[model samples]
Target chain A: MTTASRATRNATSRPGGRSARVRDQVLEAVQAELADTGYDGLTIDGVAARSGVHRTTIYRRWKTVAGLLVDLLEAGVDDTWAPADTGSLEADLVALNREVREALSGDSSVTLAVIAASFRTPEAAEALTRFWDDRYERSAVVVERAITRGEVPGDTAAARVVMAATSPLYHQLVLRRSRMSRAEADQYARDSAAAAIAGLLRH
Target chain B: MTTASRATRNATSRPGGRSARVRDQVLEAVQAELADTGYDGLTIDGVAARSGVHRTTIYRRWKTVAGLLVDLLEAGVDDTWAPADTGSLEADLVALNREVREALSGDSSVTLAVIAASFRTPEAAEALTRFWDDRYERSAVVVERAITRGEVPGDTAAARVVMAATSPLYHQLVLRRSRMSRAEADQYARDSAAAAIAGLLRH
Candidate 1:
């Protein structure tokens, strides 16, 4: 998996070129198949046909349905995406959780589809793990800035703070399958921030 | 789904009777099928063959594979299972989270099977929702006792605390597919408990 991930990283060296364009077209097709028919219906042939790329190329690179999903997840780790500087940990967390809520909502949520795919494939699960690890790293800056401003202790584990803030949204929407309200979603952010402020999330 | 659930409740009245025996047999078969080959491989005909319960009776009562799964979850709400009286909220939560980790750990985890089933079918989702509602009610006693012991605020949302304690384990194991250690698993229980003690998870 690391070798495949490394290959994916190397592929990024050719941004906005022919290889990148092909990758985009194929991943778009993967999402369409997942949205319309889910993981059970996704196939290399289908993806190749839909993307107008040859199946030989998909097989040589992706090798499996999981390959396309892994690359799709790699594409999700956008360099431009970051949490807003809300000047308060709680407010920022509220904003972050709301973003997660937006991702999980709707009938044909691509994030939900990806999550469902991960449940069915080990490679997809690994890709999702890497994706979240990157996300946690990106979001940890919120707590670092809070520490600079004297909002939370320097010893606070920033990733745990992010996990507390976002875990509840996934808990309610994904695991519980409940129709969680915005207020309910926001409270979890407050909970994590309050916990961090109290020095309970210390390393 | 509610009507089907209602029918399931009615079937429970005749405890240890013929109907009860048939349910036990069919549900046992459902677990077997789910463990051996997940939701995609499950079929009413397969259950009929495995359980030796007539197919007509299964079709009449259970109606679908989801029906069998719903009853299987109902059967899991055992009267004998209760959190240990560890005499502290954090410890009790650790005990509870440990139990969840155990359920989700094994190679052929039936809880995982049921969770996967929930993602594929609306009825299974409803059944799982009801199942967790019951578990939450049962687990809430730990929080109530904590309030009485003055370990946390009187207005603490016990279920939210429970969700906090458990959600991280699910997030890491199911979503991230990370192999979390028992110590790592225990930390989340502590995290949730600390948040509650800080008066953060207030209703």
Candidate 2:
């Protein structure tokens, strides 16, 4: 969940208490440090200072930098995140791709940080794989809704379709390491939606 | 170019001299080390030890591990490798994607090694960007051939079409950090080809 939403929830449910708040601040600090200085600059002491959490508590709880990263990904997976439904496959896929584009854009993105971290750490790689798997499954709702609307074939491979819609954005941002105009990013979503409507994407 | 090709060229040309041979061996050692140990383990000492190219020579020439990586990427850009011509748009794309899949599939892929390196070092990232830009330009021959053969519409965006065809492979491997069956990998190529044919990928 976003920090704002998590804080609002904490306000509503005081019983979640100091433990939940501590996890939230610590993870937020980790994200900030990673975004500010990247994977190599990430350190347990940096996180402790930034989060105002004691070093002993952090070391006792998370143990290592990789441990903090895995917890961050796990928290994202456990959050109530889902794709926005727009009543049509094309619109829905566009919405999904837009989120992806926004997440990966700007200077020192947290998404890019964690992704780059996965390249360096085996535990981070495993956590990132699980994170993408959960994300793909959740995004499959777009295709399922499309099938229900009769916009796409019933046997359409949901995960593949989602991958098609979002991969171009990641391709430009991460693989190619470049930027694109927002219009160009949206075109990728359009292409995937059109391909699905043409029945080209199937199991 | 492959080492075999570079060796053959050096043999037939003979003008490359000892300097060229030194460069080739040093870069090859860098690739092997990065593949085996990844970015964090990459060091000038390891490269010098493996290459037998004197640490003094390495420091005088490449300077740092990042410098060595940048030179390796430049060599690839300078090579004469081109996509094959299978006549049809889909077949040509399949051939291209097949090459990409092969490059990234192996456990110690130089392709994956350098790609992952780009995340850790700024110089490597810049060189990788140039590498992809050069690659996309070269691969556009596939779209040019298709346009001439009446397969795809005129004014079809060559780079975008190429990116559409190949981005999914990078996505599955780098972004998602997962494996797919060969059949599944080919399906992404087919999707892009079908999209281009439908004029959905028009600029």
Best by lDDT: 2
Global Cα RMSD, each model: 5.1, 3.0
Best by DockQ: 2
**Candidate 1 Cα deviation (angstroms), residue B115:** 1.3
**In model 2, what is the error at residue A142, expressed in angstroms?**
0.6
DockQ comparisons of all candidates to the true complex = 0.63, 0.78
User: Against the true structure, what is each candidate's TM-score?
Assistant: 0.83, 0.91
Model 2 Cα lDDT, one tens digit per residue, A105-173? 777778888888888888988888888888888889899999988999988888778878788888888
Show the colliding residue pairs in model 2. Answer: none
lDDT of each: 0.79, 0.79
lDDT of 2 at B6: 30
Per-residue lDDT tens digits for candidate 2, residues B1-203, read 11211322333334587998888788778877877887678899999999999999999999898999888888777777788888898988888888788777777777787787888888989988888888788899999898999998998888878887788888888767788667776787788888889887777
